[model samples]
Target: MATRLELALLSARGVGKGIRLLEYVGLVIVLAATLLAGGHEVWRMFSSGKVGISDLLLLFMYLEMVSMVETYWRMGKLPVRMPLYIAMVGIARHLMADSSYHDPWLMIAGAGAIVLLAVGVFIVRYGHLRFPYTQASEEATDRE
Candidate 1:
């Protein structure tokens, strides 16, 4: 026979496990979709007579997304810089693929976004290096 506190804890643990399972399932779906899209792009590039800059850029974005997901799956934690790097690459791709020489302002805005993401990556790196956590916290996290 368990006390009310014990029962509540058990319930909480069950819910936590359920949520984690759902997260893994979601990640698997994302991985599958990314892989399919990437494979399609590669096949199309091969089948077509020419591969344009935009096509390569789109493929690169897909690859970066897959990398981010794989890193998260392996590390059990996602780094703040991964998405920033992706965003920077995405912005660059957009600027190169969709820019018109007539509209300098649009190009400037995309370039600005790249710069902002770069700064964010720098900040995240500095914070992690400057305020490193103790081994105790690492051990506790591993137990979880």
Candidate 2:
């Protein structure tokens, strides 16, 4: 016979498992979609006989997204810097594709954003190396 507390705990664990399953499904779907889009873009470039900045950046974004997903799948954690990289590339892609956005101020702001993301990546890497996690610390965190 299980106590009410035990039953509640079991229910919570079931819910957690369900959520994790959904997350896995969603990630797989996203990965497949990104691959399809990248394939289509590459095909378009091949057919058109010209590769431009926007197409290259789009491929970079697709690659980065796949890398992020694979890292998450393997490590069970995604670095904060990954999305920062994606955003930087995304902004660059926009700048390359959109000709009407030729305002100097906008360009400066976009450059500033990329610089900030680079700083964030440096900070995260430094912090991770400087204050490395240990197995005991991880176990203690899990208990908490």
Highest TM-score: which candidate? 2
Model 1's alpha-carbon lDDT is 0.85
Question: What is the alpha-carbon lDDT for the whole of candidate 2?
Answer: 0.90
The weakest ten consecutive residues by lDDT in model 2 span 135-144
Task: State residue 44's C-alpha deviation in candidate 2, in Å.
Answer: 1.5
lDDT of 2 by residue, 14-104 (tens): 9888977888998899899999999999999999999998999999999999999999888767888899899999998887788765898
Candidate 1 lDDT tens digits, 8-93: 99998899899878878988999999999999989988898779887888888898889988987887778888888878878777
RMSD of each: 2.5, 1.9
RMSD of 2: 1.9
Off by over 4 Å in 2: 136-144
Model 1 residue 128 distance off true place after TM-score fit, in angstroms? 0.6
Error of 1 at 52 (Å): 3.1
